[model samples]
Target: MSGPRKGKPVQPGQTVVVIGGGISGLATAALLAAEGHKVTIVEKQDVLGGRAYTFSEDGFRFDAGPSWYLMPEVIDHYFRLLGTSAEEQLDLVKLDPGYRLISEGASEPVDVPAGRQRVVQLFERLEPGAGARLEKYLDSAAETYTMAKRRFLYPTFQSFAPLLTADVLTRLPRLARLLLEPLHSYARRYVKNPSLQQVLEYPAVFLGASPFTAPSMYHLMSHLDLDVGVYYPMGGFARLVEALEKQARDAGGTIRTNVEVLEIETAPVTSRRRPAAVRGVRVRNGGGSVESLPADVVVSAADLHHSETALLPRNLQTYPERYWQRRTAGPSALLLYLGVRGVLPQLEHHTLLFTADWEENFKAIFGKDTFIPSPASMYVCRPSATDPDVAPEGHENVFVLVPIPPDPGLGGSGDERLERAADAVIGQLSEWAGIPDLAERIVVRRLYGPADFERDYHSWKGTSLGPAHTLKQSAFFRAGNVSRKVEGLYYAGASTIPGIGIPMCLISAELVVKRLRGDTSTGPLPVPLRAAGVAEGTVPKGTTA
Candidate 1:
């Protein structure tokens, strides 16, 4: 029933049911509940965090998803909006030299520092006078990050109209120059050394695309990583999720874990403009009577395609299958979580192991849409190196991630393939970390792949970050925050605009909430998010916009 006309301020007591208790759902529930709306978060998993869940085994704690934590401001902003600080709530520590990267054959390692100047210095060491070039590259990337955040990331554009607006139209040429080029081209121009180029473009590998194909706009990630700094929450990443759950509860939002939403209820109305205005949700329990929860709004933070095609009443669907298929989705990642018996020597908080034949590796994964027998690059995170509490005094906790193609045809026998890949990476890491017989030292180990991601979080094509951040997938080109064909339904997380990583996902939630509530109390743009060309910028109430 279309109970009320559009644009009128309805009373805040209307029930809002958020399906999926991931970062996005919890965030939406928290913001809405804070605004006096009654909210319920229905999650399939037993825990609150979706892919970002945590597990404890054999005296070791592992952050199941999102091993690396970048962009502290996003987390801090969420707290500030709730009248608190991340430091006060979660003991966040700034990790120096954010991560380490090593070429499989090379004996030396490349360290990506936390600060811009330090990063530039490291670049110089890679190549003569590369530091100056790095500064210039970061400057440009920072500019792009600032412009996109203001003009694209925060705004809710149902279609291309907002992007083609008068303001954006006038700046088309400049914006294109900033975001349209390929990342590889941009990096090659600045850093001449192959090693330096590899380091600069490493972040794109996580998107499941090679730097040569990924849009240069993603280069903005470098600025986020270098300038803003990387941080780790004390205890573990699961603690961050726990803190968020607490905030949601404090704001009066109800979160139910181990509850799976089977279907969405909708009623046809002549006045309706979008596909469906949700009436409620039907959920299934372990073994009990089915529950039908009524709500005025149902936000599906679950799989975008799953919510539309499988969960929703098919007869009431708006968009066809072709539409979703055409939208460029990002790649899915295969991950390995292991607890070693002995502390890994010389291992930092974060490390990247790169293969010499990176192009070939990417071709095997992306071009062929299959798992490469030898992955081009892999990221290893040893949280124990930074947080002593993560592992036993003499032991270490390690999480390894290798970005691979999401196609099932390519990834044969997921778990078995992951073991083989993990073994390869462990072999290389053992050599790099100067450890003898690393596999034998393993005390605890677990393997996860695209299938697991698909099952656990309902990720489409088992993608970890939504879709690849290509030229066509950037900004307005990516999925919109609000569904075009569905009213009272919004999308958040990596697949949507401003794309991937924990920080951007968090920001996506904030952007969607701000758009829905029409709350505009944020402050002036923080230096980091301000456009380089803008003479003046205003920040929204909750955001250093």
Candidate 2:
């Protein structure tokens, strides 16, 4: 599986040094390797899948980051590009009624069903004829998503040329309208129930914005939920990482774990054509080995600012420190992975416990910039319920997350504070799910907050998903896949163009490879040129004068 070659091969075996083992880096390596180039992914951690990585404790498995698997088609395409399908590599089952959302107590939980017809029916029951209105709303969402996927998503907007097409220019009005309405206002027009409205707005929170302020375009997520359908990989979300890791290796990409990148060396003068290219990377391992790996192309899937400031030399810095500091970032998550000993029948595959004071909770985090000691809203996922292999029989694997500001400034999430907050959340979960006395039912539990994300992943300011998708920090406004100042340098991750989420990160990888190769043909290229590519200085076999 390879992209069709357009011009002669631009550069051969251009040893691509990808710093980070997250899905972004792995996807980058896969695309580059498929193009007949030698690729190596260096990760600081002992495992692949950065924030999406998994950990096992005593027998219970947990995804350290991103538990939900949205947009199955995007993942399917990744596998297709790697010479297989998601079904062939892994087992995927669709979740019915995607999630359950409740307030303080759930005498009657708001069941958000899966698929368009079912969800519409559920809405109709909640509020008369609301389903038909939702269907109409979703039809519009589908159109927006189609436009977004084709016109905006797949293209590498490293420069404006890709986005300046006549087709896109004509679509500006729709795009502007989509961006104009607030998600809360937009949803309220269709659905009357406050609880259903909260359900529709959950994905915006994932973008690290409040529904009242988050763009109306976010309603596309609800459309994605009902249209695309919520799905679970057989062994849980971690299986995605494993599958991706295999693809990279299969494409002849090398992955080195426990190797932390310390510095990036780049050329000095920026040429208008090629600009400055990355020379190599210096790394340190736990065993105390410090060494530099040579490369012609370097793509960092790590935190954008960290790679620019800490890993690259001062003279090679692209953007100033003040730039990143001023940007709003997605909420840093407070995560809990719990292994329950007994049954909790009331809960579904996904659950959102809404806070009574939603606006106040948001203001506390985004506006006031403080951790909500008692966050009104939380997301809970029961992967084991859908995928039995994730845990032992009769036992359950649960992942709960609450969004908070990046700052833990004065005292951090102290022991007493985190415990108290977690307890309060569990209490809400219990009441919502109709599970009695959940506090005593836990056999195993693990808690992670801003401190853990910062320590484990080196996430900038302990942010969970990367920079917030604000107007100024989105699309062309965000970092380019190719370096603006440094040549042979690139970025592929949630922080870069196309924004956050697993699918976007995967595409970010593709964008980096596209920049290096400069073509978008489907399938593999000529064999001889593919076989003779060089790692650094030499021009690739297919290049022309």
Candidate 3:
């Protein structure tokens, strides 16, 4: 046939099929549909949201994945892009004392306040003169955050020329410092206390990298968390998903659930350099028969490795199987969804139970061998503490997550090792919370491990998060959003640019759409009111970044 059109905006009524109905996929479909393109999403699951799916049993409801809601501004920005606001669609509450951190050997938990001043005070209490140091650290982090948003995160870099911009060149020294230093090393430069170090480095784990290995540039997460603030949707994350789904459907995008994409169909390109151009997708319908759907463009928001290796032809695959095997993956979580009959007075909405040997824990999870470490650090989310609708009266909805190495050996029918691991987690949690009969009070329990992620999401190595954000796998180093061999075939989600997390996935969708529409503008940078001289270095009262 003909060669795929290049450097052309997707015309109105042009067919676009998006594979995978996850947040990124849905967001991409919505944006394209809003531009008058005929967009359709094919999802394997019975519902939308993919990992962010919600499920209920009896009177309890649980957000299957991504419990923490950081970066409220990102969510708000996304909603605004779609001609609506998060406030108009979803009921959002700003959480004070964002989370509780209980370090090993500490008798009392440290409440991470939403207010920056209170956070400074918390640091001062932990270490003498730490308050001022924290201010300096946050100031540096804020600068990085500003530069990242303006020059990095939203941009679709076709080559190294984008990195040589005047604005970026002016900040070369600062950028170099951030890229060269490890997050742990940078944090240690500010605070001496171990607890404080953990507090600063904790956000790195969410990005699927240990602070020791992750670049200091990621410390911008501190600005996002401390200055920007944490938020919660009234119902849960699922509510946000529902809102996006509505946004997509309202924009004329079609969602087909219970349909699995078998392969991305491509035709030979006239250009000798380019092998093929996307035709559409071959999908196994709900009836169990495979059929092809025609589209001018195809976007696969599913697992990057799976899409390349399984769906695309072997010759067209960008990364080899060996490349994926050598690449470091983010941690796989041992998840426990528990419905407790009574209230947990000691627990906050979000709590981090840390181990005494933090170094060993990281080594065990990301080291050569894959297994659960002893005295593991765990994150617990109790949504019922804030939203009572998630559980029955006097009951609590809790999700306990323990990050472990993505051990391919784990999971399957009759896996006693998985059961033993669950037992260990429960016992540790009970002891840490000082709840004697915590296990007995559980009226409902569901265990999810690596196998579940592999089976359900087709995740490479069952990683809950995507690839680790190491220096070699970040920004331009990460998988590209556009395909090289196949024209009009694009990719999004955690596996591609801007990396992982909910907000990044949303941005990934926007970036892909920008590429498809040939929109070259990087968009406006989000400057806080204080930076604009509307306020003085503080988030306005009752407002989030």
Q: At residue 543, what lDDT does model 1 achieve?
A: 31
lDDT of 3: 0.84
Better of 1 and 3 by lDDT: 3
Question: Where does the lowest 10-residue lDDT sum fall in candidate 2?
Answer: 521-530
Rank list by TM-score: 3, 2, 1
Residue-wise lDDT of candidate 3 within 406-469, one digit each (tens)? 8657883236777788888888888887878898999988888888888889999888899999
Order of the predicted models by lDDT, top scorer first: 3, 2, 1
Query: Considering lDDT, which of the candidate structures 1 and 2 is the better prediction for this target?
Result: 2
For all predicted structures, in order, the TM-scores are 0.89, 0.90, 0.94
Winning candidate number (lDDT): 3
At residue 56, give the lDDT of candidate 3. 96
Q: What is the lDDT of residue 102 in candidate 1?
A: 78
Q: In order, what lDDT does every prediction score?
A: 0.71, 0.75, 0.84
